[model samples]
Target: MAKSQTKTKTTKPPVAEKAADAATTAIRLKQDLRMIPLDQLDFSPLNVRKVAASAADDAELLASIRENGIKQNLVVHALSGGKFAVDAGGRRLKALKQLASDGVIPHDYPVSCLVEDEQNATVTSATENLQRSAMHPADQFEAFAQMIAEGRKEDDIALKFGVSVDLVRRRLKLARIAPELIEQFRVGELTLECVMAFTLTDDHDRQMTVWNAVKDSYHIHPQSIKRQLTETAHSASSSIGRFVGIEAYEAAGGILLRDLFDDNAAAHMENPELLERLAVEKLQNAAKVFEVDWKWVEVHLSVDYGAFRSFGRVYPQDIEPDADLLAEENALMAREEELAAANDGADWTDAEADEYYSIEPRLREIEALQKARQPYAAADQAIAGCVVTIGHDGALRVEKGLVRPEDIPVAAEQTEYPADGDTEIAVTRPNVSPPTSSAPVPISDPATTLRKADGISASLADDLRASRQHILRAHLAADYDVAFDAMLYALCEQALSRSYGTEALNISISPFLAQNRETLHPDTVAQKMLDALEQDLAVEWMTLEKPDDFLAMSALPLPQKQSLFAWAVGLAIKPQLLSDNHPTPIIEEIGARLDVDVAACWR
Candidate 1:
C-alpha cells in the first residue's frame, strides 16, 4: 500500500509550492543592485555586526566618502513602504545619512546598495564583515611615506583620508625608522611601540647601536630604549633647558629631536654644550642689574651652597615713610577696595573690567616704590655682594646682601685696659697668657678644668659629644626663655668683647658648612620638627628691602618673635666635645639646667 501511495505522486499544496518558488526567486535576486535614497534607508535589526562605530571611525569614513564617493556598495533588504534596511556597511550608511543631514548631500541622495531578502540579511552581513581584512600596519606606514615622498603635504593627506595630521606624522615617523628595526617589526620580533621608539632619533647608526645592545635582553622596553638613545642629550623640560627656551636654543643653531608618538614628552636637545652656554649668557645678563648696587655680582648656573656658606648676609633696615608716601598708599588702597566691591559678582563691560583690573598693577607699583625706598645701609652695601642663579623652578634667582669672608671687617684689638674704676674681671683661659699683671686675674674652677676620661679614643669622644649635644638640643628646643637668654648672651659677647669665651653653644650666625650640612638627614625626627616649624615661621621680613626689614620684624607678634628666636638659637648649638677630650663644663651645666633626658633623646 505504501508503494502504491508513493506511485500516486501527490501534488504539493499551493501555499507550499508558492513559498518554495518565492524563496528561489529571492535567492536569484540576492545580488539585485539599486540606488536607494539616503532618507529611505535604516539600520537592519538582523545585522550581525552590532558593535557601534567609534566617533573617530565615523569622522574618517565621512571624510573618505566626502572626498571620494562611496567605493563599496552597502548590503540592504527591502522593507515595507518602499524603505530599505542596511544589512552591512552600517558605518558607511551612517556617514551618508550625516552628510545628507548636514546638507552636504540631498536627503534623496542615491546610495548604491545590494538588495537582499530579510531571511538572508544576517548571514550576508556577517559574510561581508568576516571576509574583510584590514591593511597591514607596515603597508599603511609605507603608503603614507610614499605619499609624502610624492610631495603630498601632511595636512592635505590627513584631510583626504579623514585622519589627524598628527597621525600622518606618526605614520611617516614609523616609515622612517631604521630599516633594520622596521624589518624586526615586520617579522614580529619587535612591537609597534618598540619601532616607534626607534624613531626618536634620525641617526640610523645610533638607533642600531641602542637596538643591538638591548635586543637580546629582557629589558627591551620602549622607555629604556629612549633613555639610552637620549642619555647624552638634555630634555627641553629640564631646569636648564626651560631656562633657555627651545625657541632660543633653536635660534642659536641647537638641534632638537622630537618624539612623534608622544606629544607630552619633552624634546631632546642634541647640543647640550650650546644650551649650557646660552643659559650662562642669559644668567649673566640678569646679573647686570645687581652689579651696580652690589660690591660684586657673580653668575652661577646652579646654587653653590659651599660658596654661599662662606658669605655673611646683611638684612635691610627700616626707614620712616614721608607723609606724601603714606597719603598715596592710602589712596591706592581705597581705590582698590572700591573696585573690588564693584566687581564682586556683577558682570561688567570690557572697559569696566579693564578699569577694575588696572588697580592691581598700580597698587603693585606703589608697593614696589615703597620697598625701593627701604635701602641697605651704605656701609653694608660696600661689603655685601649678590649671586645670580637659576632656581629649581627655572626662575632667575638673585641672592643679595652676601658678604664674602674676606670682606668682613676685622675688629680692632684691645689697645687700652679698662679704667681702674671698672669692676669687671678679665677672664684668662688655658690658651691666653695670663692677662697682663695690671689686670685682675679671674680664678679658675678645678671642675671646669677636668679632662674627659683619658682612655676614650678621639672618635668615641666625638660620638659621645654628639649624643650629648643631640639630647641638649632636644631639651633646649622646648624652652623658649632659656634659648633666648643663651642667644642674647652670645650676641652681647660678640658685640661687647668681639670674641666668645668658654661658650656652651656655637653661636656664629653662619650657615652650615658643606660637611656639616650632609649630617642633617631629612628623615630624622629633629629635622621633621624643624620642617614643620619652618612652614609656620613669619618670613615676610626676609623679603623686604633693608629699610623695611626692621619695621616688618618689629611688627611680628610676640609668639612669632619667639619662634624665630628659638630657631636661630637652635641652629647655633653644636657638639662641644673637644678633640683633646677636655671636659665641657659649660655644656654640662646647660644640660643640668635643662634636665636633658639623654636616654630618651638618643634612642
Candidate 2:
C-alpha cells in the first residue's frame, strides 16, 4: 500500500494541468440531458457549422454517448460568470441544453472543456478538426481559410497543420462552394470536383437546376452538366457576343456599357435617332412610303439597336447644329420630290440609309477631322459610373481605365467564384496559359533518345524528303531516327494512299495559320486554341444541341498514336521548351508495342 501510494504520487497530474483540471471539474454538471436548467447550459463552446438536426446523427450520438459515456470529450472554455466557450460538438451540446431546459436533464451534467484564447481560436478550431478526422474537408478548409483571412500566411498555416499548400488550397476552394452543396459534400452525396464545377456561377437557381438534374438524371459527370448548362445559356448570336466580351448584356438586369456609351451613341441617346425613324415611319403611313426601293432604308429602320443608353447626368438638349455645320448642310438636302423618288418610299436598311445619306459637300472635311480627333476619351468618360463585368451578375466593373492598378481605391478583397461545374464553365479571367509541351508531366532524363515529330498531322511513317533535310541538319541519324512529322504524314498519307490506292491525299490546312502574327508565344497559341475549344465544346454541350466533343480525340487512330508521341517530342526538343515541365504521359499503346518503363522516364 505504501509503494502504491508513492507510485500514485509520482503519477499525479502536473501542477499546471492539476489546477486546470480542478477549475474544469468545478463547473462540471452531473445533470442528465433532460433535467438541467437553461441558464446553467452554455453553447458557445460547440462549433456547429450547420443546423442539420439529423435524427440519425442525434440517435447515433445519443446511443454512443449512453454506451461509451462520451469518450471524446467536448472542448470548451469558461466564460464570465458560469457560461462556457464552445469549440466543438455544438449540435450534441444543443440537444443536451434543450433537454436541460425542458427539465429532462439536470442543470449540471459531466462535461469537458479547455480555455481557448482569442489569438488561438482559429488554431484551436483547426487543431480540433485535425485531431479528429470526423470533420468534412470543406469544414476543415473554412476553419483554415478563416485563419488565413485572419492574417496567417499559407505557409505558416501549412507548417502548423503539417499539410501541403495544395491540400490547403483545395480545402479553401471547397469552402467557397455554396453552403447547400457543401452540405451535400459533407454528407457524402457530392464530390469535390462537382462542387468546383457547380460553383462556377453564383446563381443558386442554376446551381439547383444542375443539382437536381444530377440527382434525378444520373448525370454526375462534370462535363455533362457543363454541356447541359452551356446549351441552356448561349446561342449562336449570344456565343458570338461572348467573344466580344458582353454576353451578359442580354441576361436579366444586364447592359453592355462600352457599346452603349459609344461616342456617337452617347450623343444620340438624348436625341435618339430611332425616334426620327419612327416619325418618318408615321409620315410614311400617311404618304406612299412604299414607293422607295432604297434597301439601306429597309435594314437600318428595322433594327433599332439601342447601342446607347446610360444612367447619370443628362446632357442638355441642343436644337442647333453647330452654325458652321448647319450652313454647310444647306446644300446636302436635295428637292424632297427627287430624293423621295430615289428611295421609292421603302423603310431604310442601315446600310442603305448610310449609303443614301449625303453630308453637305462643304462639311465633308470637317466631319473627317472630327472622326480623327480624340477617340478613347469619349469611351473613358462614358464608363465613369459603369464597369465591365463577367457573368450575368449585377457587377459593373471598369477595365482599362486611366487609373493604374495601384491607384485604384483601397478595395476590399473581392469574393471571386469559379463557374459552376455543371455549367459550361466560362473562364472569364485569362489564366497565364503555360507551355503546351505535353500533358502535365515532369522532366525526365533528356539524354535518352527523343524522336521529334512535326504536328498532329503526321500519319503512318513514309519516307519524306523532309527527313533528309532534318538529318542533314541534326546530323544524328539519316535512317533510324526519322522525322516524326514526316513519318506521321507518311502514316496518314499511307492510310489515305492505301484506301484510295493513290499516293496523294487532299488534307487542306487553314489559311488562318498563315495570317497568324509572327513572334507569338507557343503557350499563347496553345492557350488560344484550348480556350476556343473549351468554349465551343461548353456551348455545344450545354445547349444540348450538339454531340459530345470527341472530335480531337476521335480524329486519332492506332496508326496515328505514334504521331501524337512524335508531335509532343518535337515540342519537348525545343531549346526554349522546359522539357522538364512536360514529361511524356504513360503511353499504353507504346507500352504494348515496346516494354516502356514509363515509371523510370516519368521519374
Candidate 3:
C-alpha cells in the first residue's frame, strides 16, 4: 500500500535564525514519529471523535485504508506495558482494525504513530482534530463534476460516498449553475439556499435575469426567487393541467420542464397560451352535451360567483336516476350511514377506516353523473342558458339555469285617465271619509327637522342614493364645470367647517332627490355600488394599521380628492321619470352631446 504525501515548502532557514527560534521555543516539546504493532496500542478515553459504525461508511473507510494505507499518523501516549493509548485518529484506528478483521493484514498489524508523553497527549489529540482542514464546497462540486465527466454513474458515486443518489444529483446541479452565480456563492455574496434555488432552472439567462432584478433588495429568499422565475409558467399540478391531463397536453405539443432534485417536484409548462387554448377547446366540446336542453351554451375558462351576478338563476327539478344507479346510490348511502354510526366513539379497524374514506368521493361522482343525465324544465330551458367551466381541481363544472337580463320577465302596469270632453266628478266610497289633522305636529329645530326629513335607516339611505344616482348623473352630464365646482365646494365645507365645529352628520343627499328612488322593496343598486367602491379601496386602505396611515391615505391631491367626492355625490341620482311623466331633456341633450345611447345606461 502506498502512503499519501503532504506537500512541503523546501526553503531552508538561515542558521542564526534557526538557532534563535530553537532557543525561543526550547521549553516546548516535540514528538518523534514511529511504527508499532496494533496489539501494543489501546483506545484512549479522551479521544475527541467518535468513529462512524455504519456498515457502508465503515466498509468504504476500510477499503480506502487497504488501498492506500494510513495517510496520517495517530497521536498516542505511552502506557505501563510496551503498549500506547491512541488519543487521536480514532477513525483511522477503527479502519485498520476492520482491515485486520477481514484478514487483509496480520492481526498485529504495524501502525504508525506520533508518540507524545501523557502530559501533552490530550492537547495533541484536540489539536489534530481541531486543525484538520475540510474540503471546500466548490472543490467538492468540481470533483463530482469531474467524476461525472469521466462516465461514473450518479448511483455509483453515491455508493462510493455512502450518500443518497439525490445528493449526488444535487451536487452535480450546483456544479452546473451559472459561473457568476457560483462565484457569488463562493464569495459569500449569496446564500447557499439562494444559489440552490437558481439551480431549479438550468437556463443561465433566466437565472441572471432574476438575480439582476432582485439583487439589490434584501428579499432574496429561495421561494421568492423561484416564484419570480416561474410566475409566467404554469405548474403541472395547476388546475389547467389537471383539467387537461399531462399526457393530453404533451400530445398537443406542450413542453414541461422538471426539477431534478426538488421534493414533490412540480413540472413547469412552457407554453401557457397553448395550454389555455386547449383547455377552452375542451370546455367548448363539453358544453355540446347540454345543447339539447339549453337555448344557448357558453364555455368559460374560469368562473367565479361574480360572473353569475348579472343573470338570474332557475333550478332544475325531478332529476330521477335509472334503476341501477338508484340502487347503487341507496347502497352507497346505507354503507356510509353505517360507517358514520360506527365512527361515534367506536374503535374502527384500518380496513373499515379506508372503506369509510373511499365512500364519499365515489358517492359525489355518482351524484354528478346522475345530475348531468337529468333534464331541464321546458320553461327554464326556454328562458335560460347553460355554462360549462373548469373547476379548481381541473374537472368539468356545469352551471345551468342562467338567464340574461333581457330574458327576465317584467310586469305590465296600466293607468286610466278621464275622457277629454267629460266633466270633472268626484266619487267617494260609501264607508270612506277624508279626515283633517287635529293639530299641526310641532317642529323643533328646523335644521334637525331637515336632517330627519329623509329616513335615517341604512336601508332608506341605500334606496334614496339609488333613486338619486341617475339625477346626479344628469346634472353632471349637463355641465361638467358646475359639477367640478360643486365637488370643490363640498370638499371645502367638509374639510374646513366640519373639522372646526360640530356639524350634523349630513352625509346623505337631499330628500327630494332621494324621494323618487322609493320602491315597493328596498333597492340593492346603491349597496352594490358602495360594495364595489369599498372593495376597490380596500386594497389601498385595508393594510393601514394606525390613524396616521388612514390620515395619509385621506390626504389625497386636490384633483383626486375632488374626483372621489364627486363620485360619492353621483350615487344620489335617480333615473325615474320627471314631473308629469315628462322625459328628462338634460339627459337627452347630454346624450346627444356625448353621442351616448341613453338606453344602455338605463339597462
Candidate 4:
C-alpha cells in the first residue's frame, strides 16, 4: 500500500494549477499602448460603468484633464472604421469629449489608451472599475482643509471642484473638528454624524470636552452631542429666541451657530443672556400698549403662574350692542339658518359650505368687537395691574385686570352714620370665623415652621418638606371630591368678594409649566395615569374667553369636571411644611383621611 501511494504521488499536479496557468497567461498578454484622437475614441457598450456621470463630475474631470493632460491611460479595444472603443474610464472619455466641444482640446487631440482585445475588453473594464476604491470621506475632508490652508478661497475651491459652495463650506466645517475625534471617525470609533455635530462649534476644547463626556456613554448620538455642545446656548426655535427673532438677534450682534450639513436643523444662539435681554426689552416695549390703561404694567420674559396665584383676575362683562351691530348680527344669524336649512341631510358644495361657515366667523368678529368696547370698571383698574409676558407660542401675552393682594379692599368692622338729624346710628358687623374647609389656619409659633430641628440641617429640613409635599400631592390626586370642593371654594371666593386669601392651595387657572418633567418624577406610574386621563379630557375650554369659558365648563360632564379639578388641585398642592420642619395640620389631616401609604406613594 505504501509503495502504491508513492507511485501515485509522483504523477500528481498541485491544486489550482489550471487557475495559476490562466493567471500567468493573462499577465503575459500583450497590451497595445497608443495615442489616439479624442474624437476617434468612442465609449464601449461593454463598459462596466453604465451609470451616466453627473455634470459636476464631468466638469471636475474635464478641469483636471485640461490642467494635467490625462495622468492615467484609458483601456480601449479596436473597433470598426479605424476607431477605438473605450472599455474603461468612461468618465475620462466624457470629459475629453466635453473639452473638445468647449475647444479646450482639439477633436484630434492625442489621448493615450491601453488597447485590449475585444474578448478581454469587458473583463478589463470590470476589473478596472471593481478593483479601484473611492477616496475616504475623512481624506477628502482633510484635503479640502489643506487647500484652504494653502490660501485657496472657498469660492475658488468650490468652482474648481465643481461642487456647491455650501458643500465646500460643510467640508471645511467638518475639517475643523478636533484631530482626535477626526482620527476616531476615521477608525470607525465615531460616526460621521457625531463628527458633524462637533462641527457646530469651532472650539476644539469644547468639542473634546463633549466627546470625552459622551465617549463612555451608550447614548453618544449626534443629537446628544449637539445638545451637549450647545448646552448653554438657546435654540433659534425656542420661545425666547423666537420672541427675539433671529434677524433682531443678529442685528444686535448675537452669534448664531448653524448646522451646515442639515438645512432643517435648528440653529443655536450663542448668547442666551443677550437673547433673554432682548426678549425682556421687547416685552417691556409691548407692555407700553397696556400701560396706558392699567394702573401698573409688569414685563416678564415668560409667564410664571406661581407669581400670579395671589392676584385676582377680573373678567370682561357683556355690553348692550348698538342698533347697527344688532342688525348685522341678525342678518348673519338669518344667513346661517338659511344655509343650514339648504344643506340639511345633504352634502353641500365646497363653495356653499364655505359661504355658510363664513357667517359664524363674522358673528364672532362682531361679538369680539362688542366685547372689546366694554370697559373695565374704573375702580378695578385703579387697584389692578397688567402683565406682559411671552406665551408658549412666542406671542405677546397681556393679562389685564390682575388685582394684587395689597391692593384688595378690606371690610370695615363697624359703621357709624347719621340717620336722622343729629342721631348717630352705630351698626356693628358680626365677627365671623372663616370656614375651616377653605381657610388655612395661621401658623404663629416658630415651632410650627419648617426650620431646622434638633439634629437635622437646613437642607434636610428642605428635603423633608419636599417629601411631605409629594405625599400631600399624591393624596390630593386620588381624592377627587376633596379636590373639587377645595377648587370650587377658592374660585368662588376669588370671584365674589375678591378678598379671600389662603396658604392651603395655590390654585391658578393657568397651564402648568415644567421645563423638565422628569426632574421631579421620572416616568412614574402615577404620572402616566394622570397624563392618560388628561389626554382623554375635552380641553376646548382652555381656548375660550371668560364667559365662553364659564359656558364651556358648565357644559362639561360631571366626570370630566372632576378629572380637571383633581388634576388642577394636584398641581396646586404646594409644600405645607412650615419653617420649623413641621407639617401643616391641614395637609396631615387630609393625608390621614385619605390613608396615604407613604411608601407606596413614593414607590
Candidate 5:
C-alpha cells in the first residue's frame, strides 16, 4: 500500500533554474558589507594575533558601536551550517560579543562584516594585522603613565592588559623621565638604552646637567650617564655612609635620594655636606673625649700619605697600674669574654645587640685608659702630640705620641777637650828596639838550652807573647762580659793547672770557637731569626736617627731601655744548629726548653 502511494515530488525545470540563479547571485554578492547576527559569528581559529582585546579598547569599541554603529566591517568567512567565522577583525568581533553579553545589544544583534570564502580566511587575517604599524614605545610609556595618573594601580593595569606587573612598572619608570628627555625619546633622537639611564634620578635639572655635559662628547652612553649621576651623589651603601649610619645622618637633617628603578632600590646621599660635617663632628668628639691625658690632640677627617711628614713619634713608657685598678680591669675582661661566649651559640636580639655595642665602647674606653697609663718621657711629652683621624676603613684611628723633627732636642757641644783641668800624665818607659836581621846571635848547649837562650830568640819570644796578648785584649774589649768570664775561667784553670792545652804552663782559650764558622752554622737559623727580630725591633730602632739621638736615649726610663735591649738580644741566644750536625749541649738544652722547631726554623 505504501509503495503504491510513494510518489517523489520534483521541481519543474523553469522553477529550478530560477532558484539556482537566485543562489548564484547571493554567493557572488557575499563579499559585500552586510550585518550578521552576533550569535551566528565565531572567531576564526586561523587568526594570526593571539593577544585578547584590551578592556579600554573593547569599551571604546562597544561605545562606538552603540553610538554610531560599526563604521568598519569585520572580515568573516562562511563556516559550517549558517555560522560565520571572523578572520581579520577578531577584536571587533569580541567587542561586539562583549556588548551582546552585557545586554547592551541583543544576543542576536547584527554585526557588520565583509563575508569571505573559508579558503581565504588565513591570508586575510595575516594581511590585516601584520601590515598594521605597532604603537611607538614612547607613546605606550606615556599611555601607561596616563592610566596611572587616572588612579589605576600598576597591577590592575597589567591585569587588564594581560602583561606582567614588573613590565608595567618598567614602562612607568620611562614615563616619569625628564620631560626634555621624553621629548627627545618622542622624536626618536634618544635611544631606549640612554633614556633608561635618566630614570636614576627625578631631578630634571640634574638630568639636563648630565645630558648636556655628555651629549656633545663621545661618552654619551647609558653607563656614562649612570656614572655621572652616581658621582654627583654618594651611595647609602658607601663606607662613609655606613660608618655614619643612615638613621644618624637623617636625624641630622640629611636627604637620601632613592633610585626607584633599581631592583635593590639603592639610595644616594644628597646632603654630602651634612655627611662630612657629621663625620668631622664625630671625630672631633672622640678626640675631645681622649684629649685629657694627651699634651695635644689633633683631629683630621682624612690623613694623606704626606700628613705624617711634619710629625715625629715619641716612645711610650711603662707605668704600673694600682692593684685595685688591675683587679677591676681583669674583672671587666672576664665579663667581656662571658658576653662573647653567651652570643656564640645564638643570634642576638635588638636588646642583646645594643648590649654588645655598649660593651664594646666600654671595652675600648678601658683599653684607652690602660694605654693612657703608659707614660712617655717628659722630654717627649713636651714636644710630641697625637693625631686622631678617620682611617682608610672608615673607623676612628688614634696615632699616639708623634714628635716633629723640629721638636727633637739639640745636644750641647763638647767644650772640655784638652782643657786645663784635664791633665795628660805621661809615664817613662825603657825603650825596646826592633831587631835587625843582621844582629849577632849566641847558641847554647842542648842541656843548657832550657837554662840559657840566645838574645835574638828571647826578643822574638817577647814579641810573639806581646802580639798574642794584643789579640786577646782586642777580643776582650769588644765583649767585656764575655772577656771577664773567659779571664776568670783562665785564672781558675791556671790555679788547677789542667793539661788540656797548657803544655808550657799557660792557660788560654785561643778564641777558636769564633773561627769555627762552618762547624757552628749559626747563620742559617740566625738570618731568619734576625729578620723577624729586626721587624719587631724596627718600631723602636726607627726612633733613633743619629748617633747622638741613640746616646740621648739613655734619658729614657730603665724599663724602656731594658725592653729595647731585651728585644735586641732575643735572637742572640736563639738555636742556630742545622739538621746536618749535632748541636752543643747548651744549644740543645735551650732548644728543648724553648720547644724550638728545627724544621720550621729551616723553612
Candidate 6:
C-alpha cells in the first residue's frame, strides 16, 4: 500500500510592517505647520481639483479638517519678497478661506509652510501630496497604476508607498464596481449595501439586475432581492389583496371608493334628475368591487333578476364532470362492485434473483406465487370530478384568507377526494378551541376527552387526503413552522398509501383525528410546521415552559386539529408585517403591533 502526499504552499505578504512604517513616518515628519490666517486664506481662489479625483461629498473633508486641524503644510513657490503662490493644498486653502469668510475661524492664524525651492516647486508639491493620506488607497494606486500596469509587481508599488499590496489590490475592485451602481450611490437615495458583489461583475446582464431592482424601488435592500429571487414569496400587493379581499381591503387604508349613491355632490348638479341618475350609475360602479348584488350597486336594479344574474355568473363547485374525463384523469379509480366482479387475482411482477436481491428476493418470489387478494382503490372518475369542484372552493377560501396555510394542502385534497366503499373513510374537522381559564383541566376519560375535542365528522378518506394535500403544499414553502398541516397531511398520506396492500402499514390517526395534531402534539402534527418555525421563528425557549392545550385538545371527538393551523398563519403573517414595506402601522411600530384576533376576524 502506498500513501500520497498533498503539499500546498501558503503565500505570506508582510503588509503589517509597511502599514506601521507609514503611520510612524507620518507622525515623525517635521515641517513649519500652523493654522492659516483666516482672512488671507483664499480657498475659492486656489485651483484645487474635485474630491478623490472624482465627484465627491464635502462632508468627510470638512469633518477631517474640523476635527484634526490642518496637519499638511502647504508647499508654495516664492513669487516675490514676503509673498508666495501655493504650489499645493489649493483645496485646503480654499476651504480655510471659506471658513474665515463665514467667521468660523480666527481672522489671522499661523500656518505650516513648505517653502520649496522655486525651480522644482510643482515636482516637489506633486510628489508630497501624492503620498498615501492625500489620496485614498484606491485613488493613490490609480494615480500611479502605471508600474503595476507596465509589468512591475503590485508588491513593488505597495513597498514604495509603505502599504499592503491587498490595500492596493482593491484598486481593481473599485474600478470593477458597475458604473450604474456607482451612479446610484452618487444619487444619495440608494445605498451600496443593497447591491451584491456578483451584480458588480463585468457581465452587463447581471449589472442590469442590480439596476432594475434599484429603479423599481428606490431602496431595494438585499432581502427584497432575495424575495424576488423566489417568486413564490408574497408580494406587497398580492398577499394583502388575497387575505383581506375587497371588503377587508376597503376597511384597511387601501382601496379607495368614490361612488354615485354616496356622493352628496352629485345631487348639487344643475340638472337634479340627470344628476340623480348619474349618481346611481356611480354607486353601481362602486358596488361592483364588492360584488354587491345588482340592486345594491344600482337602486333601480331588482333583487330577483339580479339574483338570477348572479347565479348565471356563479358556478356550483361540487358538480361532477363527464365520466370520460375522470377515467382520463385518474387511473386507479374503479367501481367497487364491478372491480370485485372482474377480479380473480391481483397482477404480480415476479422477482429474479441476483446479487442485488439476495434472500429477500426469494421471499418476494414465494409471496408472488401465493393467491393475491385485491385491495380497494377509490373510484377514479368520481375523485377527479371532486377535484374540479374543490379547486374553486380552495381558491375562494384562499381569497377570503379564511383558510390557514396549514389547512390549504389538506383542504385542497379534501375538495378533490371521493368517499371510499369498504374502507369507510370520513373527513373529520376540528372544532375551535375556547380560551382556557387560569387552571388547566385533566383528560382522564376517553368519552369525556372525545367530547371536549369536538370535531365535525365527514368521510375518513377526505380527512386523510386533506392531510396528504397539506404535506404536498408544505413542501412548496421554504419556511417551516411547528404547526403546519403539511406534516400532518404527510403522515396521513403515508398511512393511507401503505394501507392498500400492507395491513401492517395502516396507522391509527385517532390521536390526531379530533384535535389539531399541529397544536396538540406538534411533533406528530405537521413536519412543515417544524420546518417553518425552524426557518422563521426566533426561539425564546421560555415559551416552552408554558402550559400546553394538548390534553384538552385530545379529549374532543374532532377538536379542530388545525387550531395551531391558525398559529402557522400567524408565523406567515409575522414576516409580512415586519417586512420593510410593511403598512404604516407596521412601519411606525416596526412589526411590534401585530397581535390580531383571527377568530373574531373570521366570525
All models: lDDT?
0.71, 0.42, 0.66, 0.70, 0.64, 0.38
Give the candidate number with the greatest TM-score: 4
Give per-residue CA lDDT, model 1, range 190-219, as digits (tens).
877778878888889999998888787532
Error of 3 at 486 (Å): 38
Model 4 spans > 4 angstroms off: 1-31, 50-71, 95-110, 305-309, 319-374, 406-603
Q: What clash count does candidate 4 reach? A: 11
TM-score of each: 0.55, 0.23, 0.54, 0.58, 0.40, 0.25
Question: Which parts of model 3 are misplaced by more than 4 Å?
Answer: 1-42, 50-71, 78-84, 95-113, 150-156, 250-253, 319-384, 406-603
lDDT of 2 by residue, 449-547 (tens): 122233323442344336534545564244443343344433322221112221322332211222333554535655465334433322121212211
What is candidate 2's local distance difference test score? 0.42
Which order, best to worst by TM-score?
4, 1, 3, 5, 6, 2
Q: Which residue pairs show collisions in model 5?
A: 312-402, 312-403, 312-404, 313-403
Give model 3's TM-score versus the native structure: 0.54
RMSD of 2: 28.0
Write one digit per residue (lDDT tens) for candidate 3, span 1-603: 899898987865699779878876543333367788987888888786665557866666666677668888888888896988899877788878777888888879989888877888778778887898767676678789999999999987876765678888888988988889888888877877678777767889999998897686523445446656666777766667678878888999987766655666566677888888898889878888889878888777665333565566666566558778778889989988898898562777889888887888988888877876876567667768877887666688887887665665452222223466343543211111111222122122234445665546788667755755665678677997655545444433333222222122234342123444435122355446544653343112111222212333344555655555654444434455446487778755654776854444332
Q: On residues 1-603, what C-alpha lDDT tens digit does candidate 6 reach at each position?
A: 788888978854679768888877566444433334444433322334335442233443444465557777776644544555676777666656656667777657566765545676556555656663544333443455556668778676555544556655655454444666555555653443334332223445655664575455422444333323322222112212222234433333332211111122101111223322333354345445533211111122111111121111111123444455445324323332234344322432233212112434444433432312221122221111110001111121101111122222323232232455433455432221122222222222234445744553457547645765575457546555433333433332222121112222223331123233235443432445444643442211111100111222222233244433333233223322335564556434643365544344332
For model 5, how does the per-residue alpha-carbon lDDT over 1-603 read when each residue is reduced to its tens digit? 565767789776998999999998677666477788889999889888888867866765565565556767788888889998888888778777877888888999887788777888889888988788878888899999999999999987776665668889989988888888889877866777679878777788999998887676422445456656766565665545656778898899887765555555346677878987887788878888657766778776555433454454555766776566577667777866776788572776778667665766676676777786787665556666777876544567788776545454443221223434553543222121222222222221233334544434777878756875676678668996555434333332222122135332255432122335446454678556754653443222111212212333433455654444554234234434457366567777766898977686663
Alpha-carbon deviation at 549 in model 1, angstroms:
36
Evaluate candidate 4 by giving its C-alpha RMSD to the native, one decimal. 16.1
Model 2 TM-score is 0.23
lDDT of 3: 0.66
User: Considering only N, C-alpha and C atoms within 3 Å, which residue pairs clash in candidate 1?
Assistant: 316-546, 317-546, 317-547, 318-547
Query: Least lDDT summed over 10 consecutive residues: which range in candidate 4?
Result: 436-445
